[model samples]
Target: MLPKHDVCGEPLYTPKIIFKEQGETKYETTDPYVWCRKCKKYVEVEVTQK
Candidate 1:
């Protein structure tokens, strides 16, 4: 039988809004809110220092 992903593997989820930015590129967060996983949103990818 096939194994359950959420139990044996990684849980399915969405992306988040909060992310990084760099020069002209953007790196959106894959899980910012990290609430229900589905609440996660995403923008363009970026790069910067905290």
Candidate 2:
């Protein structure tokens, strides 16, 4: 099941992951929001970072 937006009650999507290289290590990053087609804006969702 997909998460719902707090304001719009729309289904939230998983944010994309980006990788970056710093020195000799790889780092990960992602957006804190999900895309909403109806709202046309990113909606914040619960996420756990590792």
Q: On residues 23-50, what C-alpha lDDT tens digit does candidate 2 reach at each position?
A: 9999988877789977998877778764
Task: Candidate 2: list runs displaced more than 4 Å.
Answer: none
Query: How do the residues 2-49 of candidate 1 rate in per-residue lDDT, one tens digit apiece?
Result: 211332343433334565888888886544322233324332222222
Q: Estimate each model's TM-score.
A: 0.27, 0.73
- TM-score, candidate 1, is 0.27
> What overall lDDT goes with each candidate model?
0.38, 0.81
Model 1: how far residue 1 lies from native, Å: 27
Best candidate according to TM-score: 2
Evaluate model 2: give its lDDT: 0.81
